[model samples]
Target: MGHSRFRRSIVHVNATLARVVGDEEGMSTAEYAIGTIAAAAFGAILYTVVTGDNIVSALTGIIGKALNTSVG
Candidate 1:
């Protein structure tokens, strides 16, 4: 009888703890939404910079220099 009561008390305590601690499912959804927006904005900015004439010409110059280097 005493052991049975102790077991029930343990179950009750666990239930109470679960209620207090809850879950992070909602928080995870919100965080993912914000992160996705930020990543998309960053990607748009990067695409603009990479596609500019200045960046293209600079990269072309760098590659040209590397390809033309004479072996010592």
Candidate 2:
């Protein structure tokens, strides 16, 4: 009797786990949310670096050099 009860409990637990594992209702939404947050963070970092004074000066210097070059 105890053996039978233990087997039933194991089966019940397995069934519950299977149901939980098979359910993927909000997985896509969660993945999309994480991806969006990562993208936003990356964009913010890129914007900050590009808008910094050092980058601005480097870009300005490169442009000045390009414009000052003469065509032979």
Candidate 3:
């Protein structure tokens, strides 16, 4: 009788814990939010890699040429 009661109590505790863990009220939303933040960070890094310093230098040179041509 004592062993059976102990086993039943353990089973009950396990079931309750499983129920709480399986309840997904906020887990999916948090996952999506994290994914969005990661994607934005990746995009910013890619943009910096692709066009940052070169684009700035190119624009600066074009502006300098335009000013020199127009003034002289």
Candidate 4:
């Protein structure tokens, strides 16, 4: 009786583990949603930085300085 009970417990544990492993539904969708939101937020930040006056002025200044250099 003790041996039979131990075997039954092991079978039950295995079945539970199998069910958990098989239940990977919608995980990819959740990951994609999170990735998309992160990308959008990053894009927004970059757009703001690039469109700001300071960054534009700095870029223009760099280009002007580069163009004004005289090569011997």
Best by TM-score: 2
For candidate 2, the 10 contiguous residues with the lowest summed lDDT are 13-22
Candidate 2: where is the Cα deviation over 4 Å? Answer: 1-26
Superposed Cα deviation of residue 59, candidate 3 (Å):
14
lDDT of 4 by residue, 1-72 (tens): 255774575565556545544566755666556555655655665577679898899999999999999999
Provide the overall lDDT of each model, using Cα atoms, as 2-decimal numbers: 0.64, 0.66, 0.62, 0.65
> TM-score per candidate, in order?
0.53, 0.57, 0.36, 0.56
Model 3: weakest 10-residue lDDT segment is 12-21
From the highest lDDT down, the ranking of the candidates is 2, 4, 1, 3
Clashing pairs in 1: none
1-72: candidate 3 lDDT, tens digit per residue:
255774575565556445545565766666556555655655665566457687689889999898889543
lDDT of 1 by residue, 1-72 (tens): 255774575565555445434554555655556555655655665576679898899999999999999999
Ordered list by TM-score, greatest first: 2, 4, 1, 3
lDDT accuracy of residue 46 in candidate 1: 58
